[model samples]
Target: FGKSANKFLQKCGVKNEPPAVKIAELLVKSSREVWESVGRDTENYKFILQKLADDFNNIEENPDLITRMKAEPILLGVSEGKKYDLDSVENIYINDDVVYLEIYNELSMIPKGYSKFLYECLGCKSLSESIKEKVEVSGNTQETKESQDLQKKLDERAYLFYCDYPKNFIRRNEGWLKKLKVKGIDKIEAKYFMKAKNNYKIRPVTACILEDQEKCIFNFYITLKPDYLDISKCLVMYIYKSRKSREINYLAMMLKAPLEDLKYSNNDANQENSQCGVDKTEYDPQIDQNSTNYDSQLEDLFKSLRTMFEDCDHDYIYHCLKQQEEDKLINVENHLMEGNYPKIKIPVNPYDPPVTIKVGKTFMNVIQISQPSLGSYLNENQTIYCKNIKDYSLKFEKFLDGIEFHIPKDIDKSEIFSRHQNSLNHFAKIIKDLIEVFDCAPKFIRIFYDKSNLMAFNQDRALFFNFKIYLDLYKIEPTIDAMTYWYMVICHELAHKFVNDHNSEHEVSIS
Candidate 1:
């Protein structure tokens, strides 16, 4: 796996990323989100960070840690519209965006670019925002009180963690920062640029692309020493071309030193966490451990791992096993089938008659059908058809061309602009709402089909790519329950575009 990781990195155009120097410890303020109003003091970021880093003890063995975050029910913030979680906060890492930690009514600077690097990169994204905001805004003190002390402690420590030695330390003075230029080479090359700031305390200036690539990407931890003579302290982030898109859609930061360099040099004082008070005490400001049963908890964890893999109670060898029998997981014919599926029934009038439908309390004539069904045609759904999609409702049909990207000629417009257009129009309007509420637009939307299964999207629920989403229906069902289900599924899959796994982050994003 390690060898494969190096090979993968090479494919992504990463090079020469070796282990570097370390500092003994940096003192930083800590906050705890709990009910008790006990005062907290600053502690060593190394001690606390290593504790948080321990949460990813399995990362060294994980080949994909750089791409997807291993969610651990890490909390987020609560808001009137949606609750925050690790998943929603990916922008801080992937996009140059800031989500600051509010401390004691004193706003801590979480410059947009550094916010994300400190988040998943440092495992600090789960830290609560502010104690007071949760209480006053949501009127929910119970949840906030439970984490008040811990939140407060983590808040100060988190602020110090990100700001202490954050990324893009570009403080050019006396020609201090060098370009490291070579023939036909540039470290900060890009066709597009997003605003970024330096975490340098003094003489900080906007640094151009730290390690530019063939394409543009916002993921760079751009670490530099205080003197800023082309030296690095932490893993320097690099841009990677997405294997699928062949463009800079993915970002990767060096996780840790290579396995061969696991042993930190004797001079690396702060690399190894001090056992000053790991399991011996609770809330010892001098110690890193927060709970007394830390050891027992770790023991249980190890035991669970053993049982899960070594003991064979779980299916660790699923890929190795050969399954000759039919699948026992589910039966789509009976178990997965739904009712009220055919939303539009054929009208008994073969002559088409004078068809009148009510749209929002106003009745309208059925203008013209594509191919006469019982005289009136059915749309792509084979339910009902109309002469022009615009006839259903201008409010819904407007979204087709309103999207940011041009609709590719290959995209089957039949579904979105067919006889059952009223339903499609309604869905288009919902997409518009999503765009307005989220302040972003879909690149384009297309409809596709899959005959092998009942579900087809990423999770076999709906199709999501780039910024568009669509679903191919075996039949159109206009029931409220079915419509609402599709709505939730669409939103749920959209959240996965940031955080792939379903966890607390995904939940808050949906909310």
Candidate 2:
């Protein structure tokens, strides 16, 4: 029978077969012969006969066995109990219905060949048939359909394992069966194994086996260490199927996890951890320590400015300016020379001008005395003055051409300008409130509209506002209230006047 089987295999082009196939073929045939001699009664030898019959039936019925052998034959002989060197086998034949497999123990290298005829005799469902069955199943629930898809993946993987790692499969199976103390090979039921101890600080690891009528699913559960606040858990499942006619028909693996949980866990973890090694505690200490000093200084400055504004007596100044307009007292120098008005000293940068508040018979003039040099100062006082009090008030207006503006094209130019103006007015109100309530203003305050930059500073004396920057800002953030942006910028610039340290890293903090 061995010779005939060999001849048949050679004829069918199944050469270089692995030792496992040869041993399995021999075992099937031997079991059949032994069973026939014992009158085929399974009651007396239930385990051994049943196992042998199963192996025999598998070899006889598996349709892909021959194709599998021809493609890649499985190697054997890594089992624990016995050592069988296939290389030593010399002759294999059948005599008197009993097979003879001869091995030369003295041979240094193991021989390699298996009976293709036996391999061909084994039967399994064709790949097309398996695929057809999978396609035919319908009318399943969403969950059932998902499980079916997973099963298909498992099948493909299992097939690859049977084709590539036959020896490993046998070894693993042997070990698995030994753990159960089973005397003969058969299907193993699915089971679950979880870690004996659960620790929340560390990720958990678990495993389970699920068995259906046709397939066995092995699952491994593991939790991923969180990089941030969110933690993730993964389930890797391996699918395996064994046929009555073939020990294994398919093997595959798939992974599943809760993505949202993982995402949130990571985020939460990140927030709890220190940012760039800077602790929150450290930040609080510094802020608390400097807050008092900053508050007192700001309070003192506001109080002094408020007192000065009150001293100026705005209502009286307005009345005097109105009278001057009616009287047409346009020549400020003539009025100053007449000496009919009360002269009040106004604080300003001495380098620029010496500001003087003058009240005439029917007018009030805030004059700046410009001198070319200290010698000229000793000689005369030439006046440059603002006769109208309205001219001294801060104004925010459109300073840039709408066409050159780089804001969103979709927004109307007029609308953007309006928002920009509104922002400035809102900020101006905040400044006024601060000055009135806190009783403070910069010693020499002046505001100008210019196209050169968003804002320019000359100590606290001069502030230049540009329309383009604020318009662009409003365009970029339409949702943000214009007043909020303006308030922040004004406060920031005002804070700079107080600190005056361009290099200070805590400038923003102080502000």
Q: Which candidate leads in lDDT? A: 2
What does candidate 1's lDDT look like per residue over 124-190, in tens digits? 3222221111100111113222123322322222222222121222222111122222111112211
- After superposition of all CA atoms, the RMSD between model 1 and the true structure is 29.6
Which candidate has the top score in TM-score? 1
Each prediction's RMSD to truth = 29.6, 41.1
The runs of at least 3 residues in candidate 1 whose Cα sits more than 4 Å from the true structure, single-residue gaps closed, are: 1-401, 404-420, 442-483, 503-511
Q: What is the lDDT of residue 324 in candidate 1?
A: 10
The models' CA-based lDDT, in order, is 0.26, 0.28
Worst 10 residues of 1 by lDDT: 242-251
**Model 2 global lDDT (CA atoms, 0 to 1):** 0.28
Q: How many backbone clashes does candidate 2 have?
A: 33
